[model samples]
Target: MNPKVTDYISSNIKWQKELEIIRNVLLELPLEEDIKWGIPAYIYKKKNIMGLSAFKNYCGLWFHHGCFLKDEINILINAQKDKTKGMRQMRFISVDEIDTDIVKQYVLEAMANSEAGLEVKPKKNTNPVVIPEELNIQFSKNEKLKYKFNEFTLSKQREFCEYILSAKREATKQSRIEKIIPMILNKIGLNDKYRNC
Candidate 1:
């Protein structure tokens, strides 16, 4: 067991036993175990295969390429139906909720899929990204900002645009623009803090 993952699972005061059972089951597989996003993640050839996470209500397994799994028993769930594409989660409310045999089958399938080089293709961004007027003006005024904004990936650009547009008032929009200008200049994504973790 990875010391970091052991510490993380042991620290789950609310679901220690549940987390430990999940951890032990995963350990029986061939994947390498490590800590990621403060959770126990199983990796195959440096690619994330599955991860264990504890939430307020449950501890769950996050299957990285779950979109590709056959899921013959129909247990895999799309945690975020619309936003999540490749990942799926199998949630457990308690240690008793875990069916070790079923879980093992799923893990083995996932490991096999990884070994077979199966993957879920990223969804293509088809719609044109919406750029708010506040950002448009900023881009027009500063060549560097314009260049930097253009340099961002389509998703990053969309995040910034959505953030600015979500503000209800002009002042709020302007405030958001001001706050994000440095981040744009630095080429950082709007949700980098959350995503990086």
Candidate 2:
């Protein structure tokens, strides 16, 4: 057992017992345990099989390649319906809901899937970039901003455009535009910082 995962389980106030139960069950298998992105991930054949996490309303079991699971009971959910394609989550609201038998079965199936080369590929971001109305208005008023925006590649431009378009409220759209102006002028992609890291 990884000490970090142990500490992670013990330190979690909301889902400590739940995490430990799931951990104990998974530990019985061949999966190597490790912390990835601050969550306890189970690995097999050097690939991530599943991750366990606690959310505000529920604790979740994240199957990295869950799209391959049979999901006969139909519990898996794509958290982000439109955006999430490959990853799926099985949510649990209470300790009693953590059926060890079902979990073990699912995990074993996931391992088999991994061994057989079953997989889901991430879809490439090839959709045409639609510059939000707000951003076009900014370009109209500020030629320098337009010039800077044009400096980035299409992908980067699309990222910024999508970022603004994702905001729900009018004020939020304006706020997003204001935020990206400096980034655009500095020739920074919206996700450059994280992507570089």
What are the lDDT scores of the predictions, listed in order? 0.88, 0.88
| Candidate whose lDDT is highest | 2
TM-score against truth, every candidate? 0.83, 0.69
Model 2 misplaced regions, further than 4 Å? 73-75, 78-83, 130-157, 168-171, 181-197
Candidate 2 positional error at 149, Å: 7.2
Count of clashing pairs, candidate 1: 0
lDDT of 2 by residue, 1-197 (tens): 99988888888889888888888889999989988877888999999888898888888789978889999999999898787677889888888999999989999999999999887877678888899999999999999999999889988999999898889999999999999999999988898875542
**Which lDDT tens digits does candidate 1 get at residues 74-179?**
8789978888888999999987889988888888888889889998878678789999988999988999998999999998899999999999999999999999
Clash count, one per candidate: 0, 0
Question: Could you tell me the lDDT of residue 68 within candidate 1?
Answer: 85
Residue 29 Cα positional deviation in candidate 1, in Å, after optimal superposition: 2.0
